[model samples]
Structure formats: structure tokens, C-alpha cells
Target: MLSTSTVVITSFRNVLALSVLIRVGLILYSEWHDARSLVKYTDVDYRVFTDAAQFLLHPGPGSGNRAQGPLGEGYGDPYTRETYRYTPLLALVVSPNDWLHRSFGKYLFAGCDILNGILIYNILLPQQTRSKATLYTALHLLNPMVFSISTRGSSEAVLSSFVLLTLYAALRDRWTWAAVMLGVCVHWKIYPAIYGFACIAALAGGGRQIRMMTLLKARRILWFGVLSVSTFALLTGGCYLVWGDPFVYESYLYHLHRLDHRHNFSPYFYLTYLTYPSPTVGNFTASTSDASISISWLNDILESPLTSFVPQMTLAIGSGLVFGYHLPKTHLPFTWFIQTTLFVVFNKVCTSQYFLWYLLFLPLILPRVTMSTTKAVLCISVWVGVQALWLSEAYRLEFLGVNVFYRLWIRGLVYVVGNCWVLVQLMQGYDYSYVTRKYVESK
Candidate 1:
């Protein structure tokens, strides 16, 4: 008879094959069904990426550009108005799209999605049963949202893969590799930098056993910090050399001071709407003559986009410090999830895609939690219900041309409150001791 291990291996191969087949089908459907029809399923961001790639391939002077994209420097074709708001490297990575099929980028991201599934399985295999590992891999691989985003040419899957790779490296005690990966991830998307403190603490031996000054002096910690910063600086500095100041402003600075007054899932939306010009209500500037003298000072404060970053960064950094110092290595994934949840919830701009940041770490921590199924369902319901509520109001505002900024902002508050409640429930049932014991048992 064949060995049980052989059977499990075969089953895993089968699962991976099935995932590839499913992704291929999704890619084909996205190209023909979505691309041809008026009802679009693919994200519009793909065009922006390709346009940037084309521009990079064929350099041109800045002239006759009208639609100043997020980059604010219209370097691409004058006719195309799409903006590319990422690093020059990302555009170069997808530059093949200009020559190859338009769906080339989608294929690339799909491959990353598959790689993420493999990484998920490997990360879990040592801690859980083979079947459990396979299940988690399948859950991530076959997830509709995950595949949908990847097939739509979003770089989120690629971003997520780098994050998982960092976690995988950290779990293996390859601190240097973890640091490098984390740095690359942050360069890819700025939010991953928040995990730096947790990573540093992990490298320096977390908990009260080590003094603060001693932790700072540890060689491994120093190397991790140095390599991470060096990697980020090298990549970003190199890009800046090529793309210059506009690249810096568009990619990094814009997001830092970004305040979209449009209808979105942010509690600060109404505040931004009141302070900035509203396209929804033509010729309406709430901060102008319409505003009373009593609240003019408040509007001035809100007018500065940096004002929102103060509270957001303070909360995010505080969470990182607490989790890094208090949590064990086994709890790092959960730590990241909570930190990301807080970051996204407290952000000046929250969107559906932002959910992927925390969702990437959710499966890693779920198997360790001692939560009951019913309670988990309740938490999920609350989370999704709040999103649905916000989306309904947002749809009315964006599509139906209704001015429901106040209602949408209120929904945003409810979403934030609901997410906090879910986090508390998850924390209560997390079984931190269980994870620590598992780590000890494994050792």
C-alpha cells in the first residue's frame, strides 16, 4: 500500500493543479467577457499601468499633457489620460504589455497568486495537519475576491505574496531575508512599513527578557534594520534618479497627503468634502461663503491633509510597538493582522481593496484561535454588513447622483466601530497561550 505521506503529497499536487486551471479560466473570462462587453469586470487601473509602461519604454518630453494623472507629470501619450501612480520599477516589470497580450500583467499577477497559495501551505504545514494546510491553501487560491482582483490586473496579489514571503522568512528565523522582503513590500505599497517594529522586536528577542537599550544594540536587529532601510532607500533612490521629483511626489507624497472628497468608505469623507471642492454638487465650496465664521478655524485645520495623518500614524505606530514588545513569535501573524486592521480602519481613505492587507494574514491566525464557529460567523456578519451598508449609500451618491455625503460618512463611522468590535472578539478568543505552547512543542 502507498504511504499516507505519498497520498497527502498527491492530493496537494491535485489541489495546486486545480487552482491553476481555475485561474486560467478566470483570466480568459476577464479578457473576452469583460473586455469586450460594456459591463466591465476588469479594473481600470490596468490601463494606467500599461500606459505608464509604454511611456517608460518610449521616453518623451513633458508637453501637451492635459489630464495630469496621479503622477501630476503627464509623460505618456497626450491622447491617453490614464495616470500611473506606482514606482517606475512596477511599470518596467509590466512593460511587456506593450508588445505582448494586454492580459500579460494579469497572467503575471495570477502566477503570484499561485505562489502565495504555495507559501500559505508551506507556512502552515509545520504547525497544522497536512489536510489543514491544503485547506488553507485552497481557501486562498480559490477565493473569488483574490482571483478577481488578480485577474483584474491589480498588484494586490503581488503585494500580498511579498508579505507572505516576509512572514515565511521570519518564521524560519531568516531575519535578514525577512527584512529585505519587508522593505521591498513597503516600496511596493507604503503600508507594509508599519510591520517594521514587529519585525525588529522579533529579531531582538521579544518580551521583557531583553532591555530596551540592549534590544536596540543587538546585532541581528541592527542588520535587519539596516538592510531594510538600505533596500528601501536603494530601490526608491534609484527610481528617483530616473523619474525624478514627480515620481516621489506622485507615488509616496500624494498618498501621504491624499484626501479624496469623493464618496468612499472613510469617516473623514464628510470632513474632506466640507473643506474641499465638491464635484458632486457643482460650484459648491463648503469652506467658502457658505461656511459660518464660527467654524472657519475648524475648516482651516481640516483643510490641511496632514491633519488626518497625525491621529492615524499615532494609533498605527502605538499598536505596532505594543504588539512587537508583548507578543511571542508565534503571535506575529496575528499581530500583523490586528495592526493592519487598525491601520486601515483609522486611515484617511479606506476602500475595498485595503481589506486585502489584513485578509492576507487572517488565515494564518484563524487556525490558532479558539473562537467558536457561531461567534466567528457573527463577527463576519457584522464586518460584511457594515461594508454593505456603506456601499449602498456610496452607490447612491456615485451612481444615482445623490448627495449623501453625510450619510456615507456616518456609515463609515459604523464600519469603524463594527471592525473594532470584531477585533476585540477575535482578541478575546485568539488563544495566545495556545500559540506559544505550540511553538514550544514544535521546538
Candidate 2:
């Protein structure tokens, strides 16, 4: 029989080889698909990056031709046209793609995804046997969501890579690196700031007695906090100095005013659609009426200040407190996952890509987590299945103009319930001894 060490070595080699093969296949497939031309498969957000780079590289003659200045001054679609919604750091990151083909951006994202897989593999090495570690790492590399996001040129993959590096650094007790990585991620996208409290708590050490007093007393925690704040201030202040108020407004303040009742998959979207159904629902012949109805619904939702804000604020605060309560009680990795998952789940905008934020952390904790195999399979299935159903509804509205508005609330409810179930299971942390027994028996 092969020794355990030899078996582990073999598994590691196999995982590395398979990871390369899968990534190469995805790259080739993306090239063949020509995602840049296909609107459905292509990432619309990527266009913003490339467009901003083009504008910066070659400025237009007059103000009219100055690439809309990131505030969508005269453009049709503010989101894409006023591409300054993101921090200038991302535009600078993608500027090189202007000289190369647009497809090169996709390649760069793919490479980052592969690097994330390696990071995950290394993080798992100390906790599990080599075979198990390799398998967990493969789960991240082979995830469909990861593949789709990386190939389509969404920067979530890059953001997630940085976030994972921060988590890994924290796990290794490298507080300074963790702080630096977290600052880098927050600069890329502000949402990662949600993890700030959890990082501080982790640095302060885990237990029931952990409090503000305890955290303040720890020299390492104080330094970490200082470095993190300094990093964020430097990056954001530099952007402000360079581009002025437009950079600040578009990058940070715009999100506060985002009311996407018409073209979004949030539960809030369904709530608005229910209150005001499109005319297309009743009269299929009136295709033009759909836009007017959607606009009316959006107007109502936005104009009534409390309609959307109240519920979102309530959920945000309530879920945040709950996650904070459990942060010190659970393991750091799982705590980080819970914190991120709750943010995505309860946020006003729950995009499909946002799921990647928590999903990337799942593999790191999978080996340490205890759960029945059956329940694990059920949770995974329902999570992906609900997303598929929502995608279908979105497709009907976007492509076919079917206006499946009436049943949207049902889908929203189902998605929320499924997410809650999975989250509960993860928090419970059931023993995996039975899962191991079942596997051995089957073998």
C-alpha cells in the first residue's frame, strides 16, 4: 500500500495539474466565445474600465467629448458612461489592456483567480491531510461562479483575491499584512469595509471576554487599526486631489443614491414591481408601455423616501449586530464568512456576483467545519438552484420582454429562505463524524 505521505504528494500534484487544465480550458473558451461582442455573456462593468482608460489615455478636444467625466453628464447609461463609480485604482489597473487586446483583461482576471486557488490551497495545508486540502482547493477553482466571473472580466475576482489574501494573513497571525491587504481591498471597493470590525476582533483574539477595552489594550490591534486607516486615507485622499469632487461623488456618494427598481434582482425590485405592474402584463401588444410603467414604479419607489430606505436600514443594522455578537465566539475564518454572507444577503442590492464574496471563504473553512453530508449537499444544491431560478426570471425580463413581474416576489422569498437555511446550518457547526463514517462505508 502507498504510504499516507505518498498519497498526499500524489493528490497535491493531481490538484495542481487539474487546476491548470481547467483554467486553460476557460481561457480558450472565453477567446472562442468572443465575450466582448456578446452583451449577455460579457461584463458591462468592464466596459467602464476600458472606456475610462481610453479617455484618460486619449482625452477629447472639448468638454463635450471628455468621456462624460464619470458623472454621466451627457451619456445614456450613467452606470457605464460615467464609469467613475469605481475608485480610480481599478481604472489604473486595467489601463494596460488598452495597448493590448480587450481580451487580455479577461486573461489577467483569470490569472488572479488561479492565484487565489493557490492561496486557498496553501491556507488549507496546515489543517487537513494533503488529499483533503487539495480537494477543498479544487472546490474553489472549479466553482461555476468563480469560472463565470473570472472569464467575463468582472473585478470581483480581483477584489476577492485580495480579500482572501487578507483572510490568509489573519489566519497566519500576520496582523500587519492583514491590515494592509484589507486596506487595499477597501480602496478597490468600499463594501469590504464591512469586514473591518471582524478583522479587528480577530486581531484582538477570540473569546467571550473580547471587548473594546481588550482590543484597545492590545498593541498589535492598535497598530493594525492605524495602518488600515492610514492606507485608506492616503488612497482616497490622493484620488480626491487628482480628480476633485467628481471622483469623490461618483466613487463613494453615488452608491447612496442607487435606486435600481427597474433593472435589478433585489427583493426591493420585486416589491416595487408588485406595487406597480407593467402595462405589458395586462396588454401584451403594448411593448412600449413597459418602459413607462417601469419608470413610474421607479419614481414611486425613489420619491417615497421611506419605502426602500427604512427596511434596508433595519435589516442592515439588525443583521450587523447579530453577526458582531457571534464574531468572537466562532473561529476567525468562519466568522469572516458569516460576516460577509450576512452583508450580501441583507444588502439593498444583492447581485449574483456578490455571492462570490462569501463563497471564496467557504473553501478555507470547509475542512474545519462540521456538518452532515446530506445537509451539506442540500444546502449547496438549494443555494445554486435558487440563483438559477432568479437568473431565468431576469432573462425573461431583459431578453424576451415577458415581464414575469407578478411571480418575482415568490422567487425573492424563496431565495431569501434558502440563504437563511444554509447560513443557519453553517452557524450550527454540526459534527462531521457521521459524514466520515458514511464515506468510509460507501467506499
Candidate 3:
């Protein structure tokens, strides 16, 4: 017969096991479901997949001008389907779509995500550290919102991996390598240029950047600047040799010039158009809440295609400078990176999967700090899930339905609450000189 103590411990163990299984199961479900959404046999996505596959093999790169639609009704659509905006150089990775089916590309992307997760944990871990960072990294991957990007074949995952590598190189004082890697990431998506600039600024802004390790001064500035500009130029120009027009090779840049429509994320544009539309079509009554009438002026501003992606450009520059200047070395880089991501998120016209670009860095950044294991994991997991919800709301509404929006908004609220909790914990740690016993014991 077992002792009473054994019974109590066994019962608690069972409860814990159940809770863990539920959590893991949810994460797996989230990943698989989001992935399956793109491959459903009876849907528009299947049609797109089928169309894209046919073009992948038959299309001749030698064709001078390609008609664009889905892209537009002009010389843009490369395949008579969607205007392919991605640089042809990236085709090395993306081009396999021509041989067989659309799912092939997506599966390759999924593999990249899993590999990325492993890379994150590997890089974040300290050989001789106080606590394991993998728990936190896994938490970040499981962030409630992150599922959207991981499973959808978004390029953000690849870009994010490059960014983390860039930052890691910089922290280790490998300036040249950092710039080269960052340039590659930026070419993937122009966003990483902001991060690269931040690294350069932190190295340059000697007065503001406290040197916990080395006192980097003006010399570092010149090297960083030269490397970034020169390497980026080389790759950008070189990419022309690989695909279409080097200049117009990337039609997406043109496509994104969305002076025509606006999402709520763009602060100035949306507020301006929502309150007083450009055509001055404000206060118009919708036939039904269900009937969607896109505010035309808002769409015009986004679709205008002028050199007017002002807020995004300005925010990228300002954030790179401001936070880069104020960034603390002892503070984990995740604190800084995550905050920058928030600025981008709140300030720009980001799509759903954009979070994957920054989220990948959390594993590397969080380990450098002194946070509890459970808290860290919870933060990242909810974050990934939240990203998934956000993506589903923006890009896959019919599949996830409106219910996912509730999850998206709730995840945001949870983030607010968690941040407050962190604030409280930080105060205790700084004021009293140690984290509370609750954090340590629970983890």
C-alpha cells in the first residue's frame, strides 16, 4: 500500500501531465490546421496552387515583358496569373513550384520553419548558463499568433533567421560578417535594413551606448556603413542577372505602394481617410454591417504607388536610431528587438505573417536575460498563437472564421497584461535587488 504522501504526489503529477499534453496538442493542432488551410482540395487556394504550378515550368525568363493580373491588367503579371514580384534570385529556393505542385513549395517552407526553430534554440542557448533558453525559445514559437507565418510559407521566417545571425555576429564583434548577413536579410524584405541600421547606430553612438564590453567609437561607424551599403548594392544589382528587370525585378515594391487602400495599422493614412475620406465620402451609411464598402480614398492612398511609403520609411529610420541609441547592453536584446517589432506593428501596414521575421530572434534574445522559465515560455507561446490569429484574420478569415479575431484581440490584451506583470516584476527586481521567490520557485 502507498503512503498518503505518495498518493498526493501522484495525483499532482497526473494533473501536470494532462495540462502539458493539452498545451502541446494545441500547438500541434495550430500548426497543422493553419498549414492544411492552404492545401484544402475544395477551395480558391487550391486553384491558385494549380495555376502557379503550371506557370512555374512553362514560363520563359527570356520573355521581355510579361502581362500582369491578379497582379494588374498590365505588363506586370509574369505568369498570366499573379504578378510575380519576388526577385528571381530567390527563385533558387522558390522555383521548385514549377516541377510538380504548389504544396511542394509550402512543405519546403514548413521544413524551413522547423529548422529555424531548431536553429533559434541552438543559437540562444549558452554553453554554461544559469537557465535553459530552449524553454523560452519554444514558448516564442508557440506564441499564439506565430502559427500563421510558420505554416503559410511566408518569407519572414527565412528573413528572421538572417537577422538573428546578423545580430549574433555583431554582439560577437564580427562587424563584416554581420553586415553581409544583414544585407541578405534586407534583400529578402527591406525591413531588416532598419535592424542593420540599429546595429550600426549602436556601434556609432558612443555617447549614448554604454560599453559593457568594448568602447566602440567612430571607426566602427565607417566600417559598418561601408559594409552595409557596398554589400547591399552588390547583391541588389547581382540579382538582376538571376531574374527579371533588376530595376523592376521586384514588382512587389511597386505593388505595396498602396496609396489606394489602407488598413487600420497605418496611423496617419487610416485616421485621415476614415474620418474624412479623400473623395470626401464620409458618413456614408452601409447597406449592412455585413456589406463591405472599402473606404475608397484610404485605398487610393495605399495604392497610389508614389514614393509615399513615408511612415514606414520614417519609422524604420527613427526606430533604428532612437532605440539603437538607448539600447542597453546588459539588458537582453529581445527586450529591444521585441519593442522595435511593436513599433513596426503598431506604426506600419504589416500583413499577418510579418511577426515571423522578428519572432525568430526571441530565442536568442531572451536567454541573455534573467526571466523565469515558465513565464518566458508562456510569453512566446501566446505570442506565436497570437500571430497565427492575426494572420488568419487578415489573410484566411473564411477558414478560421470570425472566431479567430476574438483570439487575435484577446492575445493582444494578454500581451498588455503580461507586460504589466513584467513591469511589476522588474520593479521588485530592481528596487529590492532580486526577483521574487514566486518566479524562481514556480519555474
Best candidate per lDDT, number?
A: 1
Quote the RMSD, in angstroms, for model 2. Answer: 7.0
Give each model's whole-structure lDDT: 0.77, 0.67, 0.48
* Residue 147 CA displacement from its true place in model 1, Å: 0.7
Over all chains combined, what TM-score does candidate 2 have? 0.79
User: Which window of 10 residues has the lowest lDDT sum in candidate 1?
Assistant: 72-81
Ranking by TM-score: 1, 2, 3
Task: Give per-model TM-scores.
Answer: 0.88, 0.79, 0.60
Highest-scoring model, TM-score = 1
Comparing 1 and 2 by lDDT, which wins? Answer: 1
lDDT of 2 at 45: 74
| lDDT digits (tens) for residues 271-322 of candidate 1 | 7777664433543334344456338677678777667777777777777777
lDDT of 1 at 206: 59
Q: Per-residue alpha-carbon lDDT of model 2 for 218-328, expressed as tens digits? A: 777689889988888888777665555666778888776565544455666654443443433332433454455457766676446466557655554444445444444
User: Which parts of model 3 have CA positions greater than 4 angstroms off?
Assistant: 1-57, 60-83, 100-102, 127-131, 141-148, 205-217, 241-252, 259-265, 268-316, 322-332, 335-339, 365-443
